[model samples]
Target: MNAEGTSTAGATPATVTTIAGSDSGGGAGIQADLHAFAAHGVHGTSVVTALTAQNTRGVTKAEPAGTAMVAAQLDAVLADFDVRAVKTGMLADLDTLALVAEQARKGRLPNLVVDPVMVTTSGDSLFEGDPKQYLHAFADSPTVITPNVIEAQQLSGTVIRDLADARHAAETIARSGPRAVLVKGGHLGPRSTSDLLYVDGRAFTFAAEHVDTANTHGTGCTLAAAIAANLALGLDLVQAIDHAKRYLTRALKAAAGQRLGSGPGPVLHSVPVHSAPEFATDA
Candidate 1:
């Protein structure tokens, strides 16, 4: 293990890019993505999709970058960096989503982990377009799409009340063109959290004891970004997701006792998780 407690043996030093928005609170969006990449020992790059005036309390205002500016950032990053994996968050609207989707289709965004960030943790919608168009535009591009229960319901038209519902939702969403879909169940249960991964017509369940804390802002972005980082580190899709899940669990646990803001804060990304507890243990 390296100094950060992340395994480095046989791991290539690679770059992972996040095409997402900026969170002034430094909790979610590109901030969370970069933190996850650094935690996994991968160099991080970013193409800002939007700018948001948000804090742990909630998002107050958001404005997407112009399509031209988004394109320029993508061009600059893809031109200069051999980014091994890409994770997307908070595309903001259909126009922004379409632009990123074009790059994914062209294979510029590799090992893509799409976190369908439609709303904030505080229940504010960030997307500003037709929901159907937003869903359709994502088809046939991402390697895996990670959606929380709310977003999964939007994508699959299913009400998820349990792991079974989540499984069905994952399968339904997988049919829409992503190679895999993870329906996150963080909001499903009171005592435990489960995530259903549907891939290759099969479903895998990852469950963990719920850490009781309000410091869960940006978890979705963090998990997706960690998946991209693990992929950039050369882990396969399932391995990457598994490792990412473990990493996020650890971060949540570490953040349980601390307070970062006036409202729900973020996971403790700066803490070293290698030996503090352990890495890649069952979640």
Candidate 2:
């Protein structure tokens, strides 16, 4: 403990996998995700589903990898590594989504955290199909799905205006397949940042101070990856989300002071972490 007497600790480092598009910008996508896993003291592996030639400014070009190549990459990593968790981002099309779903169904993707990446945090539209249709494929497993407000709207076909709406939207998406649904409220109006976590039959509201900054480039991916990191550390559902949000708050605050990009910058995940929050366990 530094200023305070409270001591905190991070979990032992373990391998985790990120199945996502390669972001040249290094702010969002796979690059950001790897950084997040390291920040959580977790080793990270990857399976590239797509590659984008873009920067903080915007996406100049994007090309998704073939389903066969994506599958091969997944196979190699899952077979070789003792991956504790797997999180997905930017499965650019139905084919990509279906491939990952196939892996999940085959029990190849463990502790799966699916980030239904339809739109980018930088206002890029990647997928056009209904998210619910794609999600139905994973309904058999108890996966965890994280979607921002707009994404939640796309996946749930429900308007998210307030906490109640967020809850309803999360529940609807949870019904699609995921065991837990986290509807991120980063797109909402200025106020306390909130997320609705709907699992099984209980819903918990997670709220935080909205850091007014443009450095929120990979907030969604980072949060999901962080949660997976916590899960790899063996924290239960509630505890993982709670710890992940706490990490995000500090990261956003730390990144607010950076000037990495002329446009929106990235959260500083490599920075030294301070006191940790108490996490719930599966006692």
For model 2, the local distance difference test gives 0.79
Cα lDDT tens digits for candidate 2, 160-181: 8987898888888877667888
Ten contiguous residues with the weakest lDDT in model 2: 1-10
Q: In candidate 1, which residue pairs clash?
A: none
lDDT (CA) per prediction: 0.83, 0.79
Q: Backbone collision count in every prediction?
A: 0, 1
User: Which candidate leads in lDDT?
Assistant: 1
The alpha-carbon lDDT assigned to residue 196 of candidate 1 equals 80
Clashing pairs in 2: 139-177
